[model samples]
Target: MKKNIPIFRTGDTIEVQVWVSEGSKRRIQLFEGIVISKRNRNFNFSFCVRKISNGDAIERVFHINSYNIGNVVIKKRGDVRKSKLYYLRNRIGKSAKIKELLTKK
Candidate 1:
């Protein structure tokens, strides 16, 4: 399999566009969220995204090399120490926020 992965760390905000099939027609759907964790293991590489919808926390995992995914755009990088952000699951409101990492040019 060809490698075409984006360089995004856990805790970053990203948007994933995926192809959705509805009946005979197919369309691209956008799923935007913060990266909670990344399961990197060669071909089975996948990432989990978390977002608050309708006042409820929603999480979705997507495969890195899946054909169904159209795009994965990173919006912001975060300053975090852990590889898995499972602790964010317990956070709510303002407490669930992750600090943004600033890179100097």
Candidate 2:
């Protein structure tokens, strides 16, 4: 992982800015979602993000140390009881919501 990226837990919401290349042009694209899980590898680290778009659930995996990733911003920390939120895949509507964790500044 790159330096100074905030330590995020499984249930936290994050926005990742990624670089996209089209022809000879490059632009930054944002991917915001709730973290589903984090994976540790010998030399690679990755995380899974889930979001609901147009009433459809979408999940994407991102490599933490990739050059394509420009920034990772934390939006919210959830008060969750599970280490892995795979159960959230089956939830819909109000049941899919995660309670936000209160923090002291």
The TM-score of candidate 2 is 0.91
Candidate 2: residue pairs that collide: none
Position 72, candidate 2: lDDT: 93
Worst 10 residues of 1 by lDDT: 1-10
How would you encode candidate 1's per-residue C-alpha lDDT over 1-105 as one tens digit per residue? 535557888999999998999999999999989999999896678899999988899999998778899888898899999989999899898899999999999
Q: What's the TM for model 1?
A: 0.92
Question: Pairs clashing in candidate 1?
Answer: none
| Runs in model 1 lying further than 4 Å from the true structure | 2-4
Which numbered prediction scores highest in lDDT against the true structure? 2
Assess every candidate by TM-score. Answer: 0.92, 0.91
Rate residue 52 of model 2 by lDDT.
94
lDDT, residue 105, candidate 1: 92
Model 2's number of clashes is 0
lDDT of 2 by residue, 43-76 (tens): 5789999999999999999998899999999999
